[model samples]
Target: MKKEIGSEFWTVEQTAEKQHLFNAFKRNQRFFLSGRTALDFLIKNIKAKKPIRKAYLPSYCCHSMIQPFLDNDIEVIFYEVLIKENKLMIKVDPNVECDLFYTIQYFGFVDEQLDDFIRKIKQQGKLIVEDATHSLFTAKAFHTEADYVFASLRKWTGLPGGALVWSNETLYAPASKTDSNKAYIEKREAAYRLKRRYIEGEPIEKKAFLTLFDEAEQMLDKDYRGYGCGQEIQEQIEHLDIAKIKKNRQENAAFLCEKLRFCKDIELLYKAVKQDTCPVFVPIIVKKHQRDPLRAFLIQQNIYCPIHWPISPMHKLNVGTEALYKNTLSLVCDQRYEIEDMTSIVNAIIQFFERK
Candidate 1:
């Protein structure tokens, strides 16, 4: 039987032996229903302390990441991010005035240049918010200069509802309660359970769980208020074997990097997985015309790759940023798959390109 590669996480039995993952950054920490909710609360918390008129955000970003600032009535000024030598380079103008600066650790690779940029802007008394959603498992996930840090826990694990937000300073209570998001959480949890059964070769239709996932996502997109995380989800997070998960991801990413390093039709965003990096996905840039075709081919082979994002026209991105958005596709390198699974994906990709 062929195994599916990437999509929503299926439920897994919790290990009896549990471990704490965020002990280092537990101080001033608060949990929320999702990352966007965490971010909404963080923006409000910051605005409560100081008057924030505008925020500087990356041009290449998910709309969800930018929406919180807009919801809080803060103007968002975008900085250009370009791919140079297969690495993401962020361009921020130091002279430009903004109350808050947002930074992202893309695909778990820590950019030292971004750290320096944060330090410089911090000296100017700007509040820094680091989005560690992709880099949550990395050794250098948190930035020293960042006043606030937030990550979406669901991105890394099979959880119903979870996001973590904390500050170097004291944190304020979230405006909304988790009760408002109970329906969304229940739908997602049910979906995870159903997905697990399907994955284990049960005679279940794919649409059974997919429908639940879609409903859950729609609920989130429509109303991502400042809802706190459910107690059950928080408990689930506490019981996770974070170290094992991180190690698995790192090894899988390394194997893929070594195997697909010189593929003719695709270029890897990161050439190698570093000791400190825990990659969420092994991203590749394909030719604009062939990207969709390649993704479709991989799907036919039981590989489900995802585009990082389709750029929003609202951002009015630069030419380079637009091209990057059009061509980028994310390959699965998460904890769910092993080296053998990655080998299968690699062979399928090679087969697709060879046919060209």
Candidate 2:
């Protein structure tokens, strides 16, 4: 028997109340189609206010992280993030003055040191745009002092699409455009149908539904017609329970850690979980040779783990980041999983290494 802890679809009844979720955002908050769209909105508006020649971005970030800045004709300067002696270290050029800086609260784990670093950058009079994509369910999401903060909400909720951009100070968003989310809705529906067929042992229906899902993805990739989130996604967020989501993820992560801590072959990336942090996933590091084998074993058991990001040529020379990219595995521990699922996942990993 196999159980999957990720990839969820929601019915209308599962949606949350709008007022409850919308109330979380202040008057200055605005929604966008996606995080990249929000980033584009922020950069365009910020440039309109002041000249932005150079923007400091994280070197160990995804390519999409730098795309918006480049699209805005802003110079992109990469800064280094190193993991030294089990502690995260970040370095930036003090002499290089930038109009803005972009960074993230990686994996929802924020410490006093990270706070201090952000403050230090603030002291340098640089406009900071913090990406809270992974930290949306954490306490730091609400308490950040950054000039602009945004996140892709689709990652956390059962919504087809949504992202939010907010600032303590007033910032203008791009004009909105209306478009249909028919493709997005269909994609989710197809996924649900596919799963049902799989459970019923109907191979023919399963294949048909899978093809429907693929077609939906292709349509979505070609369709970026809307400027902001659709009404459906907005309604979904309204009904969601943020606190419970955070609690479930935290408990599930702790449960998995407790079960797997004694395994010698796996190294937990961050052993100590902070009370304030809402973990998105439990990350582990393995020998380079064991990485693919372990990933394959989990896949065979219907346990899906993701690589945080692919390593690029730039990362190859940076020993710390290169090692992390090559060996790190992010185990899904989102709010969807319970103790039983976490235990099953842990047992699967232990069995894999035991046979190795």
Candidate 3:
């Protein structure tokens, strides 16, 4: 049978495992419509308590990440990031302090350098917010000294609408109750249909599933900051198997690296997994000329890959950011797939280059 490899998909049982995993990180976590929504809410609360004037963020990052601060009138200072030996090294001027310093566990690889960087920022008395969207499955997932941390739960799991914001201390109470709003109703319906088609051998068109999934996603795209996730979706998060999710992703990523290391047309952006690392996807820098063609080929084979992000109009003006944006592509290697799935992806990738 032909296979379709896409985003992470989960069943009732799986989402249950996720809830258990989430509880392990912190006793309290606030969920929102999306990561940006959660982030926007958190920033607003932080600003209310302290005068946050400027933010230092990596030069190469998602546009959504930049939106919250800019919308609130916080100055954004871009820092250089160096990629060497399959590691991302962030270069920030320790002396040039900002009210808030943001860092990412890029593709789940946070080495000693990143650890020291986080330490330095904390020691500097800067309010830190670590983006753990890519490293949600790691052991030390919420182990941060940062005042606030937020992650895009939908990125790593099958849930249609949810993001989480948590802190080390009981800074404030989360929305005590989840509501039964229209967005929640739509997401639950679509998710139910998609899960049935995915796991129960239901005869449904691929487009049918996608349309429902897209509809579910659109529900979360609205600016619903400070809103809590629905009870239905929250329950879905409870069943996710954190350990199994981490193990599968780590093994699959390793398999892809070992299989495709010889490809000259692409460079593995991250290769090694440290103890605290749990990759969400396999990232590679496709040769500029071959990038789009490779992406097209993968889609043709029903193996959809996505560019980490397309540069925003503002970021496109930056030389480094634009180059990184155009070159980076992420292959889905989440816990949803197994060895056979990865093997097929590898074969298709190799065939694409062989024919080129």
Best by lDDT: 1
TM-score of each: 0.96, 0.86, 0.87
Report how far residue 2 has shifted in candidate 1, in Å: 5.3
Tell me the spans in candidate 3 whose CA falls farther than 4 Å from its real position: 8-19, 22-28, 82-89, 173-181, 184-203, 215-219, 274-276, 314-317
147 Cα displacement, candidate 3 (Å)? 1.5
lDDT of each: 0.85, 0.71, 0.73
- How big is the positional error of residue 31 in model 2, measured in Å on the Cα after superposition? 1.0
What are the per-model numbers of colliding residue pairs?
A: 0, 6, 15
Off by over 4 Å in 2: 7-19, 22-27, 180-189, 196-226, 312-317
Error of 3 at 122 (Å): 2.0
Write the number of the candidate with greater TM-score, choosing between 1 and 3: 1
Cα deviation at 199, candidate 2, in Å, is 5.5
Best by TM-score: 1
Stretches > 4 Å off in candidate 1? 178-180
lDDT digits (tens) for residues 139-185 of candidate 2: 76633558888888767755656787888767664435654355665
